[model samples]
Target: MKDDSTEISARRRYFRYAVFSLTALLVMSLGMAIVPRQPPAPAETPFSERARAAALADALALRAAGQELAGAAAGDGGPGTDTALDRTVTLLTIQARALVLPGDTPTASAGTGPGHRTAQASSAGVPASPGNSATPGPASLSELATDLAASGATRLTDALEADGGMARLLAGAGAAQLLAAGEIAALAGVPAAELPGWQEPAGPSAQPSPARGCTSAGPSGGADGERVDPGTGAGLGAALTATLDAEHQAVYGYQAALTRLDPTAATQASSLLAEHLDLADEAETYAALQCTAIPPTPPGYVLDPAFLGAPAAGLARLESATLTAFGDVVALSAAPARGWAVSALVAAARRTANWGVDPGPVPGLTLDESQLPALPDRPENAALTASPAAT
Candidate 1:
């Protein structure tokens, strides 16, 4: 009888232990269910990095195309091959400097900028190979134009706006790319009229006085105003005035286009008109801060007859002209002013593309008209070339 009692006691102890273990497990699981876990954070891309990557991609593509062009030119002795190659090299060199390499200053001049990614290659005074590695695959001239018009200028614009030593370098580099892209587009057979500013007028070097017989005169002072000290002004006063005048022309052109455009096209025209007006206002405000005279808006601007019925083409031409003026501003302005001009130029190129205009090989710079085939003689077209006035 005593042995039977002992066995029962042991069995009871084992059953209790098993129940306690089960309860503990259940409590633990419930606690775990009640608590939420935090997620891992996402990685952020640095602004400088993003800008450098975009610029590197284009530099590679441009260098590859340039090599092919050089080869073809060498084999066939083409007339413009050397010119194209030279421009390509100059552009690539500037882009190489804009790559945001370690130890590079953001404000370095493109012409004398330093970079480490291709420091060795650059030291040799050659177009640094793309990525400081083997050349990328071939890119056609048309492909280059498309790439540049699509993203190159805008990417550089971003870099130009970023804070630091690099932004200044990007401004110069970006401007050069805009000029080269337009020139290349023209060479690729894009219509001359399609890229109004792509081809340089006969006497681009001559800066006419805005005061002389100023038909399209504006508010404060004219382009004829005396030159200020380059050291102190960085040419901001003159550049701001020029840009404001261009903005006025843009506003007027877009306004005229809005009246004739179809509903869909009219909306785009209206938006651009407002944008130009805002830009004009901003320019004026900046001029005031600098104590410079703001040019007044002209009474009327000249527009092509074609624009009266079909606004798209006319608006596009005006945008191209504005783009040219901005490029010139970039070339002449300093630091912040140049950065602003770069952004404006990028926007203008985008607008021109929207209006059925293909940004030529060089979107912003004027090319020699001789390179293009002559257009059919139109006396009316003379008005288009007669003056760089309002229209």
Candidate 2:
């Protein structure tokens, strides 16, 4: 009986030991699954291979987002980076940090007296102190042009004088203006270049104020004379042609409206249609005079088939769309080429507005806030020379 008791105790002890081992094994597995070891923090990586890969991925994502914001996709530089240009811009950004001001107004030095003078109310206008003719501004574009020519100024300086030295001149005055306007663009606190970006202001500086340079002379009068260059005629003529093309397309679209909708519904639409046709004819006449071959209808220009009802209404819709489609072409065209296009667009827009169609105003046909083209520097640009005038 004592031996039997000893054997039972031994078996019991063995069983307890087995049970404990199993329990311990189970607990270890559970702990492992519930809380696995954490990966090392990424920042701890010191230029490791995996870290570099991660950094590159983040950079790519940022670049893609940036490209989208600029209205240009990642592949827009046409599949290759202009490395030299990129480097140049980077350098320029460094330099422009100084010596340049963004949108800085001229320092006002208490003009006149106690009361603030409106822009024109300066004391200088109160009869120049004695013999000085109010610092003698070049009274006319001609006088300014003469001054520029006499200085034998560089192309850039000539443009400044031509346009009244920022105190005057508007854009697209002439080649000199075009070049000069473009020259110092880089000097400004921005990515400057030879011509305006298709994307900023038309020039490096402010818009060239308008002037009637040499217009008083009849193509051959004299000191107050315009230079007559066939080139000028050609440019203007080209612009006229482009205007006509746009008008024709627009008119055709309006015609389509007449058939698709009720005549009564189109009465006002038809009137707008008539106006476009008249403007088109006028453009054609201008083209006839200059003899420049106008380009074909703007690339991808199409009739709006979707707007079959109420041509006038359809025009209202398509006007903005069409102007945008052609804007790039106008932006990229060379100076001489662009002059007429801009003028044509401006005139056509105005005429269309007068017809009560309201072609989105000048903004519809010009640079706007959303997308700015690079501004061009003033260089000698096309001017109305007398020789180019019709006899």
Prediction 1 TM-score vs. true: 0.44
**Residue-wise C-alpha lDDT for candidate 1, range 1-391, written one tens digit per residue:** 9999999999999999999999999999998888867778878756655555545444544554565666656646355756766667655644554353544322211221111123222211222222222233344565455444433434444544343333434443454565555667777776423422221112122333434333333323343442343433535566677778888888888877777888998887888888898778766665554456565578988887887767788888778777656665555544455556666766777788779775443455544444433222212101000000101
True-vs-predicted CA distance for residue 256, candidate 1, Å:
1.9
Clashes of each: 22, 48
CA-lDDT, candidates in order? 0.54, 0.34
Candidate 2 lDDT, 252-305, residue by residue in tens: 777777776566757866876787776565455434333434455554355555
TM-score of each: 0.44, 0.31
